[model samples]
Target: MEKRRVVITGMGTVNPLGHNTADSWQAVREGVCGIAPITQYDSSAQKVHLAAEVKDWDPTVYIDKREVRHMARYTQFAMASAKEAMADSGLDLSAENLERCAVIVSSGIGGISTTESEQTRCLQRGFDKASPFYIPTSIANMAAGQIAIAFGFKGMCTCPVTACAGGSNAVGDAFRHIRDGYADMALCGGAEAAVTPLSIGGFTSMRALHVGDDPSRASIPFDGERDGFVMGEGAGILLLEEYEHAVARGAKIYAEVVGYGATCDAYHITAPAPGGEGGARAMAQAIQDAGITADQVDYVNAHGTSTPLNDSGETAAIKTVFGDHAYKMAVSSTKSMTGHMLGAAGAVEAIFTALALKDGYLPATINYKTPDPACDLDYVPNEGRSADIHYALSNSLGFGGHNACVLLKKWEG
Candidate 1:
């Protein structure tokens, strides 16, 4: 089968460091840490106190009071990002074209804040105190559904829920939809707002969060002293269309979606396979799909979650896939600044990768003072670097042993 070409034309994001795509990218390029002492809720009693929360976000400005009340923070973020992405796409959909545009956004855990609030009402007040909108706000697919409804996109709408890989999977699925002639374009990405009391406590009980209070050192991916990931909340959205269609419409292409690969460890729920064998397979599959050799790949936006296991496993996987070239490639984990946005992580990182390819700049993996020998790679450590990249790979590995990779190539028309 001949492969259908796809290109990214628009991007939007609301991250912990900033509320928009440009601001977030600038903060990441500057190696600024967004993690800080928890300010949304009282964290004095919790074992972990730091997170990269979306600071100064007043959803009321973007969404009305009554409308915001019916949704959770994750949904709010998704809606805002979708609005921006559609606007950026410059797609003036007519009545006929409206049915050809689609939306597919995902989340690892959605409406966690709503769940916490409803449970509090049930336990503290009474069952009757629970709001009627609790169920609509708490479901996982509502993020995608609400976005579709808001924009009146009636095409293929889906939400992939593979833990941290959810975002990348959703984007990849959207690409497939257009490639298969199911839709002309898609507004695809992911959103996450899981930093609630129950979420923090659950992850803390599992020893998945960094106990360090210092924002600079809290979520240091590829660092020897890295304790664990810092929870974060945000959303990322991208507008993707068939390459020829975008070109015909005079859309500004950012990068081409060359390949997508996904695999499951089938070994452990939370722990990755030893030596990152599963991750290596995923990366190899993506390279094969792109019909390109590993040497052609210039950079990798790593899924380095700051967890010791993931950092080491990802490094091993890259070595297996690229061999000697792995040492020369500029790899970085923007999570070092954005924290771990869970389902939204992949989308934001993919945006960074596309921007890197577009601007000839690689963002840094900040706070790399203490290096880990086990995770030895270039890592674009501490400072951004300028490099003309032709091809780039973005990786996303999730809980439940899910691994996904996407390959992007510089646009040349």
Candidate 2:
């Protein structure tokens, strides 16, 4: 018997660019940068002051106000995105086998803000002030656990904690679950809300964050002027179902999950493998699994973090995998607009790839002024371009040398 096929039925995201998927997509398409001066707190002491913080978010919109205090912001973001995804899927819980559904949400830095504040209160205010919910709320798996409990998806609830690659890892893992007959459907993605004082300060100390106040210039991937990534926070979720099941339910298919590849450099904790060798391998394996030539991929949602190393490394990876064809593909980093969404970056980008295939439009790498020669591929600079993408690839390379890639094909049937 052939392996089952997986299709993305619904997607939802709450990100720096927008409060929801629609708004986020529109903002990226318009080449509008979401990075702004940090308003979460006074950053006068921090060297990095800009971030793509989610705005106008009201947790009570999707979660109960009473339960909100117990949940971390990351969990809240996950729940909000999951709520939209579940509703968009149109899956009737009463009619389906609830046991066949699953949830896998990822987070790089789970609830650091919660941990930081609680630790601060415990140290400064008193040891008695530490909230009892600290352990429950600060763990990385709570996003998956809480989302599972909230939606009652019980099959295989888990979290992939692969640093920045967590989101793509969860997505790829979910695809396998549906394909291998372990589950018929899965709610999978990633979330993060680690934009606290500690996270910012830590990244700043490591020189991994952009030290700029200009929103438009903060995340200019592939640009010669690029410095470091602009940190962002949010969640992105997708409802993936077996192809036949989705068709039977008259589900609105956004795209089909054709291939997934995961690899690790075993090289470094913070830096990508010297030349993005692991990333190139993952991209090659994904395309091979898709049974498509490099030229068939019309667009690439690059893991261009705007950092000099990452942008150049990803470009080298593309060239290594695609060779001359790499120059032909329209590649862009939505991170140019949404900033670096940490663990949620890959899932959000996977959604962008699907939407690009479905809508026939590619989001641009905004603020691309001076192009770095090493990163010479077409960055789809400045404005959104129209393209009938049959196959799109999204890349996510994280700390600890984790690399994951997913291929999405336009669904016409």
TM-score, each model?
A: 0.98, 0.98
Best by TM-score: 2
Q: Encode model 2's per-residue lDDT on 313-345: one tens digit a residue.
A: 999999999999998889999998888889999
The runs of at least 3 residues in candidate 1 whose Cα sits more than 4 Å from the true structure, single-residue gaps closed, are: none
Clashes of each: 0, 0
Look at candidate 1 and tell me the lDDT of residue 23: 89
lDDT of 2 at 315: 94
- Flag clash pairs in model 2: none
Q: Pick the candidate with the highest lDDT.
A: 2
TM-score of candidate 2 versus the correct structure, residues matched by position: 0.98
